[model samples]
Structures are given as C-alpha cells and as structure tokens.
Target: MLYWLMKYVLLGPVLRLLWPTRVTGTENIPENGGAIIASNHLAVADSFFMPLHVRRMVTFPAKQEYFTEKGVKGRLKKWFFSGLGQIPIDRSGGSAAQAALDTAIRVLRDGHLLGIYPEGTRSPDGRLYKGKTGVARVALEADVPVVPVAMIGTDKVNPIGSKMWWPRRLEIRFGAPLDFSRYDGLVGDRFVERSIADEIMYSLMELSGQEYVDIYAARAKELAAADAAGVRPAVPAQPSAPVAGDAARVPESKAS
Candidate 1:
C-alpha cells in the first residue's frame, strides 16, 4: 500500500515533471513472473529513475547502511527507502555476497522482479566494469531470465559526489531478456558461473557502451586511484627490436 500510494500520489507527479524519462523495450520485461532486471550502475539516480519507468514494483537490495541511521533523520531515511521496496542488505565483508545472493534468490522464487546492478557499485568514471558472478548464480539457481537494462544520461542528473540534482533528460533502455537454459545443470561449477557472468556483461557492454574491465569492482577502484595519482611506472622497452636488415630477411608466416 505504501509503495503504490507513494508512486501514485507523491513521487509520480514529481518524477513525471522533473525527470520525464523515456523507456524503450519495457515490454521486454515479463508482465507477471520471476525475472531479474540487471542494470548498469552509473549514478544514484539510476535506482529511482529505473523503477519509475517500470510498471511492476521492482525491489532492489540496498545496502544496510540506508536503514541503519540514528534519530529522526535516520528514521526518515529508512522509511523513504523502505517505501521504495528496497531490501536492506548487510554488506560488511566475506559472507555478505553469499547472503545477498540468498535473499535475491528467495525474492525470485517468490515470483517477483529483483533489480540488481551487475557492476556491484556505481561507476566512478562512468565505465562499466566486469560483472560479479552472483547475478548468474541467482538466475541459474532460480531458473529465470535476466533482463539487461541500460540507463543513459542519469549521471548528469545526480553524479557521484554532487549534493544537488540538475535538470537532465534520462533514457532507460531495456534490452531483450537473456536465457541461460543451456547451462541448466551446471550452476555450481565456478568456471561455468564465470562464463555465464561474462556473457551477461558482454550484453550490457553493447547496451551501455562503457569500457569493459576484466577485473572486479574492488580491484578497479585500486587501479583507478593509481591512475589518478600518476604513479603508473613505465615498463622497460623490449630488447628484441629488429634491425632493418633483419626485418627484410624475415620470412612471412602463412595466413590461416
């Protein structure tokens, strides 16, 4: 009731006027069934904007910090996020990933739409990183289709470190649902899980047009920091540089 009330009464009008989002391929989402809406994480606004365009109430696994504030401000924050159907997740360390996956699977088994960002966190530089295999695990375990969603222009509305929001046009593009029935019986194997996750990331790459990094989010952060510091140590030049005479004497290999 709270979700619908807020959607229809409060947020609906404001979002309609302010953002005025355009969503394509919304029909690609299953009307009433268990499905995972996997999207690229660009900015915080991605969460609110994506849900506004969808007909169904999409529940996302929000960090537990959103629900664990103190005093009146805390209470209000919890209420607002909760009203949006976000499940508070305790993302501390080690076991946190497994716990989140468990909760997500439960949501799917109950025949609900679960919204997850495969990139794990918001893209600091707006480049898409490699997706964690947890998404593939949930889809394979729950036996559902993973809808690849690409959100464009949201970073401009509310960027990573901005306190105020600007008026920017947002576009939500929902790609066709990806099926993993071919790997039905191979869910537990780590190799298979990684392969499926790569496939999903590939689809998202085409949708979002962000640079693809083979590493996960944590390592990406480290690399980004190093790059920012200008501490990239240059490698020594190769000692096997060919002379002009050697280049002319070299034989060419046969083309395949």
Candidate 2:
C-alpha cells in the first residue's frame, strides 16, 4: 500500500535522517485494537512526525480543503494526504461533527489507530489550549482508551507561516492510556463531556510540558486576528444555572 511504502521505503528513511525526531512511549500503544491518541497540535509537522515514528499507521480526519483544492499544487497535496490514508472532514458545523464521529467510530470498530488533535487546531502560540469535547465523545462512543501524546519542538521545525523545514530536535511522547469508561452511560451530559475533555487536555499539558490556556485555540486565534485588524473582540457571556432536568447536575470528572 502507499502508506506502507511511504513509511518504510520512501519518506521514512529521509525524515528520520534529516530531522532530529524522537518518539517515546511507543510501547504504550496497543499492538492491536482501537484506541484514540489525543495529541497536542503545535505545528503542521505534528501530523507528519507523529505518524512517521509510530509503527502502526495512525489515521486522523483532516479538513476537506486540503483535498478539494484545484491546480497542480492542490492536486499534489490532495494525492499525498489521500495516499497517507487520512479521512477528509467537512469541518463546517454540527453535521460535520457527527460525520466525523461516525467515521471515527467506524475506524475504531475496524481495529485501527485513530489520531486526534483535541485542541481542534494547532496552537497559535506554544501554550496548550482547552480541548474540544469531540475527542471525549469519540473515545466514549468507541469504548476505547485515550492516550495523551505530546509533540515537542515541532513548532520550531515548521514555525507559523514558514514553508521550509528546519533541522530541529523534536520528540513525540505518548502517555498512559486514559480510561473514561466511568462516564460511558453519561456521555450525553455536556458537563461530563467538558470534564472529560479537560482531563485529556490536562494530561497533554503534563506530557507536553506546555503552559495551559483555558481558552479554546480557535477563540484565541480569532481574538489574535481581531487584534491584528484593530477590532476589539466581544466578551463571552457567562453560563446560567443548570436547568431543572439537566443530567450534568450530577458532579462528574472536573465539573468545577
């Protein structure tokens, strides 16, 4: 297959030699079975180096724009990512979220590795942002352990707006699998989902040794862009008291 050839034959040899990439805790990965590898997104290279070091082919859902672009350059990008076996996701709204979970469930059911960036997008700065609940949803739905992976120094390899790769020391550290089986029956609870996502992000913060930011990465980016545009960002509204019939009333993972 193209993935096998790329990992073992073509690109693998070249990458391992050129960049100072090191992967640890690979033994933590189950040899077989569906598991979610929740990693911190630092740079574009995080996608490439993470899979390059792992023996098993780790597949993740990528934004569809990468595959749908036109022209020669676009064609090459599409073919390369498709050949790498990544799923193309719409990333539009709720429908895309459901579709992603559906695809992820199928991938997990097929006993393949699923790589996910809980932060949703790469960090604008090096700090780790609050993880989206989608990752927790996938793990709970698939009934698999969530492994926290920290990608170190990848930002230096491919810094923001830099097209060329720099020969920098990088590492991929995988932590012990996080079991969220306790919240299986309560996945629908938004608070429980938030707790689970926060727990995963906490583990990533420890693993990656990056400063933790409570705000979501997307929000941070939006605020940064607004600042660049000389426009003030609106303040987020506070949450009201829990509704009478809310299931989240029951305390879970990190409700506080």
Candidate 3:
C-alpha cells in the first residue's frame, strides 16, 4: 500500500512533472517473472528513475546507511526507502559482499525483478567502470536472464555533490536480456566468474557508450584520494611534433 501510495501519490507524479523522463526499449524487459536488470550507476537518481519506468516493482539492495540514520531525518529516510522495496545492505567489512549476494539470491528465488548496479556504486566521473563479480554470482546462481540497462543524461540532472536537481531530459534504454544458459551446471571457478562479469560489463559499455575502466570502485576511490593528496606523480606528456609523412604517423623505426 505504501509503495503504491508513493509511486502514484508522491514520487510518480512529481518526477513526471519535474524531469519528464523518456524510456526506450522497456519491452526489452520481460513482462513478468524473475530477471536481473543490471545497469551502470551514474547517479543516485538512477535508483528512482529505473523503478519509475518499469511496470512491475523492481527491488534494489540499498546501503544500510540509508536506513540507519539518526533522529527524525533518519526515521523518514528509512520509512521512505523501505516502502520503495529497497533491502538494507550492511556494506561494511569483508562479510558485507557475501551478505548482499545472499540477499539478492533470495529476492531472485522469490521470482522478482532484482535491480543491481554491476559497478557496485555510482560512477564519480560518469565513466562505466569494471563491474564487481557479485552481479555474475547472483545471475549464475539464480539462473535468471540479465537485462542490460543504460541511463543517459541522468547524471547531469542530479550530478554528484549537488543537493538540488536540474531540469533536464533523461533517457533510459533497456537492451535485450543476456542469457547465461551455456554456463549452467558448470563447476564454480573464480576465472569463470571473472569472465562472466567482464561479458556483462562489455554489454553495458556498448549500451551506455561510456569509457570503460578496468579498476574496481574501491581501488579507484583509493587512487582518487591519493591523487587529491598530491602523493601520485603527474602523467607524462605526449610528443608534440609529427613523426612520419603527411598522415603524421610515427615511423616504425622511431616508435621502437
């Protein structure tokens, strides 16, 4: 009841008027039954927008912090997110990853659409980074079709560090479902898991048109912090002059 109330009475109407979203390829999503909607995380608004576009309720695993706030604001936040079908995930320590995967498997087993960001977190620079293997584990274990979804221009509408939203057009594209039947019954292997994750990320890169980075989110964050603290050396510059003919290609001998 609360979900419908918020979907229709609160967020739905407001979002329709405020941002005026356009969704393409929603038919790519199966009309009914269990499936995983794996997407690139560009903005926090993604959690809201994807659910708004889908016909059936799509549940996502939200970080536990969103539910564990203190005082009135915290209470309101928890109530709101809970009503929206978000499962609170304790994303701290080594066990958090396993917990989230376990929860996702449960959701899928219940025969529902599970929405997950393969990247694991919102991209700080709007570039699609390597996806965590958790997504692959859930899909393989659940044996559900994974649909690749791309949300364009949403990052601009609600960019990072911005408290307010900007009025802008948003596009949500859903690619055809990815089937992993070939791997069914295969013995669990880390290399196989990594390969499956890479395949999914490649499909997302094609759909999102964002530059792909090979680093995981946690490592990328560490690098970003180090650069901010001026501990990392500057990147080297490229040659200024042309090295070969009118085409300006470097000579084979000189390149070596």
Candidate 4:
C-alpha cells in the first residue's frame, strides 16, 4: 500500500516530472523469477531513480542507521525509506556482513529483485571501482542471474553532500543478464567468485563507459582520508582474500 502510494500517488510522479530519465535495455531484466540487480554506485539518488523506472519492485539492503535515526525528521526518513522497499541491515563488517547476506538471500528466496552495489561505496572520482565478490556469492547461493545496470549522470543530480537534488537528466542502462551456471555448485571457490564478480564489473564498465579502477572504493576512501589527515597509509603487500559476506561457505567445502 505504501509502495503504491509512493510510486503512483506521491514521490514517483514528482520525480518523473523533475528529472528527465532515459532508460534502455530493460528487456534484459527478467519479467519473473529471482534475479540480482547489480549496479554501479553513484549518487544516493541512484537508488531512487533505478526503482522508479523499473516495473518490478527493487529492494536494497540499506544501512540500519537510515531507519534508526531519532526525531521527527528521522521518523519521516524512516517511513519514506520503508515505503521505498528498503530493508535495513548492519554493514559494519564480519558477522554483520553475514547477517546482511542472510537478509539478501531471504529477499531472493522470496522471488524479489535484490539491488546491490558490488562496489560497496560510491566512486570518489566517478570511475568504476573493483566490485566485492559478495555479489557473486549471493548470486551463486541464490542460484539467480546477475543483471548489471549502469546509472549515468546521477552524481550530478545529487552531488556528494547536497541536501536537495537539482534537476538533471539521468540515464539508466541495463546490460544483458550474467549467467554463472558453468560454475554452479562451486560457490565456495574464492577464485571462481572473483572471476564472476570481475565479469559482472566488466559488463557494467562497458555499459557505463567509465574508467575502471582495480581498487575497492572503500580502500580508496581510506587512502584519501589518510592523506587528508597527514598520515601515510600502509598498503597491503598482496591483495587480501575475498572476504565476502559468506566466506564461511568456503570452509564448508573440501579444499581441492
């Protein structure tokens, strides 16, 4: 009821009139059954614009803080986001990551479109960053297709720290669905997981035409913070293991 009111009666109509949105390749999104909507993170508005145009209800795993705020303004935000079909989960890492994965799995099992930003955070410089393998793990565990989406010009719609969205044209492009059937039953393999994630990122890179950076967005932000703090950040000697949300799945399998 709230979803319908927001989409048809309220915010959706207002957004359509305000922002000129262009969408393409929507046919790539399956009309039914479970699928992952894996997209590049841009502005926070990316979440709003994607679901507004799509016919299916797209649900995202949002940080709990969005729903847990205090005061009247916070209450309004909570209500608005809940109506937007977002579920709150802890994103602080470790067990919280596992819990988030569990929630996403539940959403998929219920035959809903699960929207995730494999890059974890928005790009600091509008370039595509390395995707976390958690998306791969989710798809594998849920046994669903991964649909890559590209949202262009969203960063300009609502810039990094802006409270209000300025009118702008945004593009939402959906690429072909990614099939990982050949690697079916190999969910616990870290190498295979990274390969799948890389393939998805490659597709998104092509769709968005953004320069690709091999580092995670989180790491880049950390480095940027360190630089501003006038402290040198230590670079890891080797790429850390892909500790995605459900890495325990790896231990359940016998090492080959």
Candidate of highest lDDT: 4
How well is each residue in 16-40 modelled by candidate 3, as lDDT tens digits? 8988887888998988778999988
Q: How many residue pairs clash in each candidate?
A: 0, 0, 0, 0
Q: lDDT for every model?
A: 0.80, 0.83, 0.80, 0.86
- Candidate 2: worst 10 consecutive residues by lDDT? 237-246
Q: Per-residue lDDT for 1-256 in model 1, tens only?
A: 8777777787777977988788899999999989999998988888888888889999999999899999999999999998888999888867986898899999999999999998889877677777887898999999999999999998999988997889988888899898887767767766666666777777787887766665666666776677678876322122122121112322322100
How many pairs of residues collide in model 3? 0
Please provide TM-scores, in order, for all candidate models, with all chains considered together.
0.87, 0.89, 0.88, 0.89
Report how far off residue 217 is in candidate 3 (Å): 2.7
* Model 2: per-residue Cα lDDT over 80-184, one tens digit each: 887676889888988877987899988998999999999899999888887898887888888999888999999998998999999987888999988888776
- Provide the lDDT at 41 for model 4: 92
Off by over 4 Å in 3: 233-256
**For candidate 2, what is the TM-score?**
0.89
Clashing pairs in model 1, backbone N/Cα/C closer than 3 A: none
Off by over 4 Å in 1: 230-256
At residue 165, give the lDDT of candidate 4. Answer: 88
Cα misplacement distance, residue 113 of candidate 1 (Å): 0.2
- Candidate 1 vs candidate 2: the lDDT winner is 2
